[model samples]
Target: MKVITTSTQTWQAKLAGLLLLCTPLINACTDPSDIGLKLDPEANRIGVFYAEIPLSAYLVATDSLNTTNAGVLVAGGDISDYFGETEATAYSRMAFSTSATKPENEAILDSAKFSLEIGSLTAEDLDETKTFAAHKLTEPILDTAYYNFDQLGFEETPFASGSFMLEENSDTVVFMNIDEALATDLFTKIKDEDPVFDDIFSFRDYFPGFALKGSPSQQTTLHVNPGTNTGFKLYYRNSEEDTISSVYTIYTSSSRHFNGVTNNPTGTPTEIVTEKNKAYDVGALVGSKALLGHLVKLDMEPLSNFLDTLDNVIFNRATLSMGPTENFPDSKMPIQGLIQYFTDDSNKILRREEDNAPYSVQLGTVLQTMTDEDGNVVPAVTSGGTNPLVFNTSEYIYGPANTREGITSYVDALYRTDVMRTDLLLYPAVVSTSGTSIITSSSITRSLREYVVNQNSITLKIYYSKLR
Candidate 1:
């Protein structure tokens, strides 16, 4: 997004004054950067999420187990008879959910029950029967799914948009394309005001009922109460100066969070909610819908811890799954290494069930690298996918499916851990700048907007020394 650059006079006096002020403050203060506005939160808030990305990669499936027990039950089932049985050859299709959809969306993707080598894939080296535990997902896929969409004769849309009943009588669909332009423009405007970034808060929100692209962005949805004019259209890299009037009012619905403000004149938007959308009479008041809606603008206390854990979680999975495309050269069954996490603890890191699982987060240490009969390292390959939420079981049944090799394969694709992680990761921290002194400021919507150039090139620099 381009900056709304405007020239200002008295530039000579301001630059000299700033250097002088900096000299004294820099010497006096231990950390001169610490001097800035203090932000206040609006209220007690928490974040609910559905998806996120990892800072690095991690391992998922392994060949060896580190349990003290000769054999422990695991989700993949027992391997007690691994060595007893013959080293059979079986194959399963290689695939990864580059995208995901809401559980509510119908299964259109030809998600095949990848034929498994049940007999050949034995954990016989294991002395005891082990089972991979069931758990919830913390960060599931929140994007589009080509596999399903292509089958359903639907094309993937580049944007996320939706509409709700304004109230009882108003039946208008709010179609929006909250593209990069919106974030860029908004951040630029914000930076134009508060460059020091004394108080810059970030949060994430979701619109469970609205999102269409796969699982969608965890913090993309938001509930905007249009004090009076209940309508807004957000286009990236744009600035609107009151087309007709300087004011506009947009009302919010119940739980549905909106990704952006877009009004489309297409499909006949039927009334879903019975309530009227005119009750939004107040200005700047946090509506109850904020909580009900999945859009979580996560804050400090919750999101920080969540992000710390989530980053680690996704990184592990990404490393294993996102490898080269050609994982196993010259093999009929080309399976992409979509990493899967299995913890035994009752209270799993993300979410878990009652199991004598260990209290260790050292998943990497315990599970050994997968190898073939010739002791060949099975290369884990993928397209660098985050934890994509499996929205359904019918398409690709995970639990107890018979393999071509005459053995029962049990699996329960879970979004519990991914879900829990998503909710916690996207709680946006509310950041506001307040002070008597003036500095160049820009919006934090887009990270790039935070940098101000041609002047000091300092981060979040406010162009104006004082409010005119």
Candidate 2:
């Protein structure tokens, strides 16, 4: 009872497969040993011939089959070669007997043994590789956890718990469901001396080409009896049914706010802040390098590259024109820095009593309501939910040191004629209701706005005399 090995034929099939797949380089560079294709040098493995058909079938005993003992076939006896072409079932295309299941059972007749022999297998010859009754199928197949006899081998083709008769020398086995998770584990077990040869046990019937000592006829005959589960290969072709494709670029993020926003919507009552939401769409200038510590800007690319960094630079109501004095938002104190700048720029070249200084303006906005798609009245955060523009704090950009703000100084410097010539814009479309439609609304709004400004940013400028 000599044990035979299929290492030789297996290598030939692999070579042919490699050439067919156009991966000749892999075949040439790889070694059967390095590739993990090996076996007990003297041991023999059973070999069986088979054909693949769509349906399942069993191997039956046969006699009176045509052979050197021919004429016995023409003689036609009651006895028929059950496994032959005549009595053969058309749909049934396989024959797996006891001898094929175990190495020891395969006598000189069923057993095949050969020595190392190198050979060639072109893509065209790949089809010539002998196939045996074996398979690896997908799991939970057709609901019953079926398996396909078409299954082949790679590193490990485990047999399910009760898939076969406990035969002697049964090195191959199948698991209920073998996925990539188990590929490595399975490969390690069945690879004789070379774990790399594990591919030979892969159910996909795929193998990397490696050196072989013999011709293509020396194939390892593996017997695979599908479990109660049906015949289906689960993700047979690829190590993974799903692929990992990831893309990575750059990213950035930041938080910003315009200092003016803290004041809130112009008309909003201090108590009303809790009642609404606000948004800003208009471009802002505060975030600019001006106002130094009063504003902060950042490089947004760090957050998300795709996201627009353009608008990421922003102004914080907290940091707006505010100085330690505190009127601006995002600030703990008032707009002292601004006051300093105003004082600096307003300082006369020689403090000439008549020196006229340059002038600039700060813009702020008021909050308003908008009807969203849902027809819900939404608080518009525009400019701290205030008006669309700033107070034009610039009027104070260059004013007398004693002025509440350049604006007030501007007022002081103005004469009756100058005041008349200077154009002032009321946030309301109409100065007072009298100028436009609902005169009533205008009057009320103008009165309230004047009062609020006078109370807040206005008062700070007047009393501080710090040119805030």
Candidate 3:
């Protein structure tokens, strides 16, 4: 995408004078920069310039995300015409609770079961039922992290299985009966104080973990929380004459669990962005899709080139305003907002030059009301206007314009250097700031792919102090 150069000069000076006057007032009667002191806009016959530059957006596959110890664990299948078929398998290591005690001697094993604490659900249709199976993992979950695309080996036969209709508020737990024989063996080992039960690490070698796999169903995925209360259980009678029963439970380790996702993009819009073609333009096809390992990459080469034409320029405010496509489906809630980060060539987020941490921002969300042709006021979404996703880019263009010298070590590298370029990746996420600040993982898609970038409404609006 390129800036409409035809109107560049005409639009540059439209708000030049007005912004110069307002800048001083906007800064709360403080000088924004020394550049304003040196080159007065009115005295030098210069003003603040503005230009709208178009940007190229691609719905590209995101780099594999680290799913280790992810706050939310998802399982089952999520099928969509827009995203294709996405399946998730959860792997978790089971450990004996610190207070876990052995069952009584001569205890008769009754039964065993595995259960999942369902946190939430993302489904195309709730009427459809999904069958989930719990298979013993062949290997232990590593202390190291696991990626969303990572798959661990598990037993072919499932020891337990259950079927149920997925719901967000209705169901709390999904339970499956475990094999009696296997349950009895586990009961005996605990009663006999087997060496494997000596420690959590030792026990993990004998019994690795459980891999919860779901049968393909409608687009429905369960966010399961296999915390301390959810896992394997053994029920047994203490003795022949004892009416009372004893229970021993193995809890899942929170720090040692992760979800593996498999996305088959066959016969879907995402198919175009396969391994060979990582980035595909969202020209007409409902804009760009997110999650299912997908992201939107914005290239601002045209805007960078346009910025080169001006000299002695101090950019006051550079805002990139954009929003979701107007034709977004009504079935799914629109993504609240997007998180932006600079990306490397591999689409991995780059670390900031100052702190070595990735620079990210929750773009400002704005609802701009406008009058239609018939003189009726309506929300932008109603009139197909751009719902504001305004991102401040002044610091990225140069240094902080409000600073004393307006010079910083972290500035100027991004836009000027090809090595560290100006490409940005946008992910569907919501940042919460209640007590503790929390950012939702971009890997968890909610199974709703309606939040696509509005290509037509995207504009890089630059506000610059045009000093000659």
Scored by Cα lDDT, where does model 3 land? 0.58
The 10-residue segment of model 1 with minimum total lDDT is 446-455
lDDT of each: 0.19, 0.19, 0.58
Identify the leading candidate in terms of TM-score.
Answer: 3
What would the per-residue lDDT of candidate 2 be over residues 1-468, giving only the tens digit for each residue?
011112224555544332333222222111212221134533212211111111111111111111111100010001111101111000011111111122111111111111111111111122233221212223211112111111111123322211222222333333233234333332333222233323223322232111111111321112122121212122211123325322111000110001100112233222122311111111221111110111111111111211111121111111111111212222111111221111111121111122343222221222223355667543232221111112234342211222222232222222111211111111211111122121111111010111011111211111100010
Q: Candidate 3: misplaced stretches above 4 Å?
A: 1-54, 108-111, 169-171, 236-246, 276-278, 286-291, 302-337, 344-346, 353-355, 361-421, 435-450, 457-468
Across residues 200-306, which tens digit of lDDT does each residue of candidate 1 receive?
A: 11111211111222111111111122111222232221224323322111112121111211111122111121222211112111111111111111111222232
lDDT of 3 at 199: 86
- Candidate 3 C-alpha lDDT tens digits along 176-214: 898877787788888888888888888888888878777
TM-score of each: 0.15, 0.14, 0.67
Q: Candidate 3, residue 119: CA error in Å?
A: 1.8
